[model samples]
Target: MNRKCDKKCLELSFPAVEAEASKGIATLSARLTQNGLPEHKTDDVKIALAEAINNVVEHAYSGIASANVQVNCRLCKERLEIVISDSGAPLPGLRIPDGKPAQLGSSIQNLPEGGFGWFLIHQLTSEIRYERYDGNNHLCLRFDL
Candidate 1:
């Protein structure tokens, strides 16, 4: 875990693996609060960020050597912008997912085990963007503070 922090910006770069993702998310949440992200909005930001990073770990680098996840957060007067980038697989079709909520079935046995990631991310973030260029994928999530 390596980070550079200042009054308005927090930058984090780490390996795109499960353990690192967990620690990175926790560390990011702490730094965000210290950098003045409102308490009420912290959970939203953290959830969205974790989803984004998990995608990079699970889907992006599924069969390839794990790469690094680069996170840059900028806090302005009324908004927080987070850019998470990695050298893993690009999003399918190089586009953002539709983020439809996973269907809840009639019984516990029929319930989905996953698929809520993008939906919750879209719900929590004010804006989301994805770009694939130069063999890298960049996902940006924004929150209105």
Candidate 2:
């Protein structure tokens, strides 16, 4: 189960990392559209957010079933702040690129295997940050509407 905040910002906290990756994306997408973001931009933001959370599930948790994922979303005047956290070992030396998908690597995995979420997120979002604290890995994505 997920908890929703009552403020302008909707915060959803989930226990399973994989479930959080999917449900969080849907909830945030709805909130973005409800908050007056255009349809095309909202779709893009949803895609990027899905990728970020998927990374936490696949890479951070390494398919472990006992991990927990926390998704906190805040809607401000200028942008939306999405925070995805997991109780797992921190990822070391993982860096997000700073450009479009074209500038990223041209590997078949991104196209045929569908592992391009992180790369697309790097290209689509305005800002992204990775943090590790007390054995928790957090990925924060900022999207401009």
Candidate 3:
């Protein structure tokens, strides 16, 4: 973490997926506030962070009790970047498709309720990136100030 950048990082473990996601979002919002981010961008940052965290919790764990989701947040000048990583399962190597209504309840949709997460993420964030490496799934989102 860069001191000049006001970068802050947090690591939390939660048994409930929703709880984990919500907690991660709350933490991000608080960090932004403490770092003097404008009020207008707070909601956008919160939503994007929640989506990234929920995707890992719901899709990777799939109702399992034992799962770990790691959230990393870095604030640089006019940008905030959040990187969420999980080790539960390998993700498909395809970008999230565009221009289609997200279907929530299918084998393709693990939680049956997280389809809207990605949609909201796209609407709120400036950039979204995904990567899978050595059995770890990583999703990174950035919000420009």
Candidate 4:
């Protein structure tokens, strides 16, 4: 990843594998604070951003050779816009998931394993959008700053 740092924008690209994704997210969260994203909003942004990227790594790239995850964050006085792109399978039906909270089962062992990510993402971000063009999936998450 070629790293760039400033108060308004941070751009990075890395292989979209599990370990790399985690490291990428951590790097993003840490640098965001230095790039003028309000401290209070960094956690929310990090959580939502991680969920989105995890989905890409776990679902989009499943059964396929991993590719690059492109991240671009632009900070404005009113909002922060993060654009994450990958050349993986398009979202099911090419739209954002409904993201309803996952249903819980009674037993501890029955607890769902993987349904809460989108719900948490929706709760954290002000707006979310997705698109696929020219074989790349673009997910834009907006957080009011």
Query: How high is each candidate's TM-score?
Result: 0.93, 0.74, 0.74, 0.93
* Residue 37 shift from truth in candidate 2, angstroms: 3.4
Question: Once superposed on the true structure, which residue ranges of model 3 sit more than 4 Å away at CA?
Answer: 1-16, 63-65, 102-114
Q: Report, for every candidate in turn, its global Cα lDDT versus the true structure.
A: 0.89, 0.69, 0.68, 0.89
lDDT (tens digit, per residue) of candidate 3 on 1-145: 2235645554554543676567767766786688777788888887777666766666677755546777777777688777777876555544553524466555664655435766788888888777878777777777888
Q: Write one digit per residue (lDDT tens) for candidate 2, span 29-88.
A: 887678766666787788877777776677676756556678777766566777877886
For residues 1-145, what per-residue lDDT tens digits would candidate 1 score against the true structure?
1133344678999999999999999999999898789988998999899888999999999999998999999876578889999999889999999999999999999999989999999999999988888999989888888
Model 3: colliding residue pairs = none
For model 3, the run of ten residues with the poorest summed lDDT = 92-101
Say which prediction, candidate 1 or candidate 2, comes out ahead on lDDT.
Answer: 1
Model 2: number of backbone collisions: 0
Shift of residue 10 alpha carbon in model 2, Å: 1.4
Q: What C-alpha lDDT, on a 0 to 100 scale, does residue 25 get in candidate 1?
A: 96
Q: Which stretches of candidate 1 lie over 4 Å from their true place?
A: 1-7
